[model samples]
Target: MQAVDQPERRATPTIRYFVRDLDAAVDFYRQLLGFEEELRPNPVFAMLYRGDLRLLLSVPGTYAGGHALPDGTLPSPGGWNRILLQVVDLDAAVEALRRAGVHFLDDRPSGVAVRQVLLEDPSGNPIELFEPATGYHERAR
Candidate 1:
């Protein structure tokens, strides 16, 4: 969709989570979910990476992230929407996370084309783990 004269561009996928404790959030992502810490520039924020995914962790009501909106609404964590990570073995991953005392919304894997379990980070933001099933489908590269 671009002109040949223009350079190609790549955008990193990013998700910002408003957490209660930035340090704990950083630890949870880095230690539990296999994310590597990319930046911890301030007390209120951190950046983590897993593959092409860039995660931004920020404390609520402190940094540039969680300030109140013009309607007096403050951003908070714990929503239904979540980031889904595909895994080879969902049960093994869930078992390991269970051993580490991770909070899971549901550990019973269930899906049509992909089995999945939902778990929460330290701040209660949902993260889904899925394993492809017999009819699993993905776009061609």
Candidate 2:
């Protein structure tokens, strides 16, 4: 067969979270979520990755994406929209984070498929940690 070419594609999706302090945000994600710092080109921006997730941390007023709008509305962190991370043990994770002085918005079990909790980064950006229900693996297969 003739050779075919395909465009390069990222294996993981990158989500950017606007932060007030880049260093603090980096510490929070790195220490709490186990995200490793990938690249930091400057003091105002950083890249973190864990598993297949890539998180871009940017300080407002420093980067284009974190810049204020034409209407003078500045993009800030903290919102209902959040990134969900799956874990094998929700209780253990929650306990560990709690012991580390992390703040949680809420922790509750869903109907029959998931147990999840919402926590915040130093920038107040929300992150959801979830554990699948008992039969989830069997059902998924």
Best candidate (score: TM-score)? 1
TM-score of each: 0.88, 0.87
Find the candidate with the highest lDDT and give its number: 1
- Between which residue pairs do clashes occur in model 1? none
- Expressed as tens digits, the lDDT of each residue in 1-141 for candidate 1 is 745563367778889988988888888888888899988888988889999999888887875488888898889999998888888889899999999999899999998888999999999999999998854476322
* lDDT, candidates in the order shown: 0.87, 0.86
Stretches of candidate 1 off by over 4 Å are: 1-8, 138-141
- Report model 1's TM-score to 2 decimal places: 0.88
Cα deviation of 54, candidate 2, in Å: 0.9
What are the clashing pairs of model 2? Answer: none
Alpha carbon lDDT at 3, candidate 2: 96
Task: Provide the global lDDT of candidate 1 against the true structure.
Answer: 0.87
Off by over 4 Å in 2: 1-11
